[model samples]
Target: MTVPEKRLHEDGDGDGDGSGANDTTALEEKRQNTQPYIKGIAGIKPEFLAPISSLSSTYTEYNDDEAEGGDRDKNGSQNGNGDKRRKKERGQNQKRDLKQKRDTVRLCVSLIDPEDESTPCVAGDEEKCKYSHNLEEYLASKPKDIDGMCPVFEALGYCPTGMKCRWLHSHFNKETKKLIKDLGKLETEKDKSFEVNLIDRESKIALQRKKYKYEISEQVIKYLDSKVQRNDSHQENRKENEATYVEQPFKIAEKKKIDLRGAKIVSPLTTVGNLPFRRLMKTLGADVTYSEMALSVPLIQGHQPEWALPKAHISEHPGFGVQIASSKHWAAAKAAEVIYRTTQHVSELNLNCGCPIDLLYKSGQGSALLDQTPRLLRIVKAMNGSSGDIPVTIKIRTGVKENKNTAAHLVDRVLNETQVAAITLHGRSRQQRYTKEADWDYIEEVGKVVKNWNEKREEDKEGRDTNPTWFVGNGDVYTYEDWYNGVAREGVDSVMVARGALIKPWLFEEVEAQQYLDKSSSERLSMLDKFAKFAIEHWGSDEYGVNSARRFMCEFLSFTHRYIPVGIMERLPPKLNERSPKFVGRNEMETLLSSSDYKDWIKITEMFLGKAGEDFQFVPKHKSNAYENTENR
Candidate 1:
């Protein structure tokens, strides 16, 4: 299915009224031009497409002129595809490179003067301490404490950042010069609100020191090497020794089972898929969530940022999966083993073979693995052998290039060669990216093959593993109709929502209701408000924390601003790629919510995260200067 180009509505407000709307001939032409390719399976009602003003009694009325024009880029003329792309690229400042770390005075935790009087500073030798122990000097150099109570301390009962926290005045007593704490609340909320999968100091030290054991990984590698050498022998000898060749040291059934049939999964979006966002997805009814892809080399080197990817909220358990990308078996096995040993919250260890970024692809990771099936198989086998009681899964695309699809052939090889618990097939090839529509037909074709393999496994269960491997379909699932349709497809066990969920987080809620929900702008704002609160809880409410939350919030807003309200659409079901013409919303707030300007996103964040300081700036990863009317060109 292809996305139809949007036709410019000269004077119509899209409410099926006014001069353009009254032209029944023009309306018919528009409908015929932009008809949906995939028919709705969930019995989509025609009334659902009615304007918001007619559907909702509480909707604020506005002038037709107010709905005519929005914030359209002057340079964005819809002359051609090149011009449209240029207009879209105008929303982003591609060269806005901001320094990650700020120049600020920070004090060590040991010299912070503990809230508990009985506790002594860990740094006994004051002069030998690496960090500044001169509390008075450090305090004088520190910027004034930010106003307002620290949301982290208020919610989580304690501030892990302590004296270094930018909102230090909230918990500090001026006269006594002592930090304050809610000791009772701290004890109760210790394990509840805190994030899981934190590697212990000892474990980190051992890994860095090269003292961490890799017995299981070493054994697995040794076995794989022996098999490679044995392949040089005669066919009869190889067949005779097949029984003695152990693929894995343990059984696949012993690992935690992943049941994804008819489940709603949130894709592990890079940068945007943080702990707070996943937590928000859980509230919206996501059945499964994955951590952002971690680099195996960094993970093996005990990198904190890579390790942070595995940290999940308490609510994510039994469904949270940690994903890692690697090109080699040693790196993959060691990374998987470390994560399995350190984290009890992980349901499955997923190998990311679908990332199409040039950096990862050039490094022989991500989509590069698709071309090297043997290496990919070895990596999966090694992960299974090393990762105790943790199910291994893989996410792949149709192929590395357009026209030439290999996922079906690769699926057969993967099912026969490895003990993967689940396989997620993204319907787009690496070459396709977002330039074209996802090939769901190809996804279903692969899913059917997996189904056949699983059925055969069920029929002959002796000696071979009997567990049925699940097949999940990913790409371009935007609405409840799209979700239900994908799941109803032959052999597709579930669907993974990515950009769709980012744009409308309540998508899962809609899927559960099995209908279109024309949520008010206020309702959508409330969801963003909840996200801000969750972000503060996870990242803290101090200056650094607030900035972190604000930055990510802006990242979220970058995608969310694309949601053209269902009520304003001329058709029944909205396509994910359909670019709407600049049109006003039911209210002023709604208009702001649908803005493509990055500045408007900042204004939205200011409502929840307080004013972004002069030091703060946000540059969207993608440009979004929506098309302007041709007359303006």
Candidate 2:
């Protein structure tokens, strides 16, 4: 199914009234265009396309100006001093909050002697404590009308926040006058092992102490450092004798082969590709999933945030990969070794060389590595050697700039110099961002190169030990048709989905079923409910947990709202670049779900999470530049 080149309204069908005959005509055209293009699926009924009131009261587009109006009024040009004071007060408040949190975590009651004055109270001194030591007082302070218990305490048997938890009334026993600590309950709960998969605190300490052995990785790092220290002319001579200097490839009698042919793979999205989302994607029929890109330096330095990236749901195993970005051989080698030592779950260790974020690019870690072919090769080779049994892979773009495509050369080099198991080539240059369509022709050409390389290698008896690298094409794959057509291209084994999956995570389900599924508004809400459940399970169901879930839900909605319902589209298989024209849905709930307004997203979250506090506010990750460019338009 193909998208129409022009929208109905854009084709000069408007009657200047902005309401009346022209509007009715456009709605009819939209209805006619809603016929299912796929062969098997039943076409949308006319009733499904019947227009509601043009002016939707249930939905309103969120205006950033309106949201920030109060702030503007208080901190406008006339209140420069007040703005500065407010900023200073905010900073002070943040510091105080951090200190208080630390104190709360550090507080511990002496289990041996609760009455000892010398022993610090985990609940602090009873006289000055913010929390009630008596269960009766805690119960009295809580609302008499409140419903339900603390989900975290109910699931884990113990609350990590202790007295500070907002649901303190839930776990405290009035009859026994004691707090129940049943932490072992988590052991039996299904899919609640996210924390168990992370690198342990002791392991991190060992890493920092330089006590954990990484013999092979250390050796590779030393060799690469020496190579870097050599004079430019000597380095050139070393390149001429590259075979002599290169480390001998490690070999086993047999290695596990990775086959991603026709696999539904999700790309490593930065902030949006958290564990809950990957788990959701797995349930939705995605064959492969990757963690968000982590920086190698932070991983080597034992940073908690970086280490968290590699944690995966047990269900994602046998197909989950942890992707890392690095500019240096040592960082890449060491990080891979750490991952190898820490977990048995990773299917592959992938190097990310296609990230285009300015900070990453400027740090010489991401797409900037494209300009330094020698360094890039060294990092990939080092990671391949250090990552034990897991296969090494790399993701790259066409190139860093427009008009010049360098991926073919890089792919050829990797195939010859390193034993990488796969290469994913995003068919657009870094500079292109999302401005233009991905260059599929160039991707097809690169696929041919890989195909020829594999054919030639197959004919050579000695090269059989070196794994046949799979070629995966990425970009603009949104539907079953796109997935099928992409893999059908010569040498392409599979496709990697990014924004497409974010916009419609059930995309893999569609690919598996080989048909368009026009999901009902209720069905879509059910998907959101699943995500919320996952989030609450992973992040806990405490006050902070609920807020974090809400924030991430909004982030997910930012993309989900872009899904123009197939039953309302002016054409079959809507293009990713096509923006929706304002139109109401058949029902108020559907219209609310369709709204792009951040306010509406928050409202939707409230349906599952209860009312948000007044302090709750959210801004999308990608700011709309439409307002800034309006003058030009």
Top candidate on TM-score is 1
lDDT of 2 at 65: 17
Superposed Cα deviation of residue 377, candidate 1 (Å): 1.1
lDDT of 2 by residue, 340-380 (tens): 88888889888988876555666788778888888898998
Candidate 1 local lDDT, 207-325, one digit each (tens)? 88888887667777666654552445566665555546656444433677789998889987777788888998999999999998888988888888778889999989879999899
Clashes of each: 0, 3
CA lDDT of each candidate?
0.73, 0.68
Best by the lDDT measure: 1
Pairs of residues clashing in candidate 2: 108-122, 109-122, 157-182
Off by over 4 Å in 1: 1-103, 111-113, 117-149, 163-180, 229-253, 463-465, 623-633
- What TM-score does each of the candidates earn? 0.79, 0.76
Report model 2's TM-score to 2 decimal places.
0.76
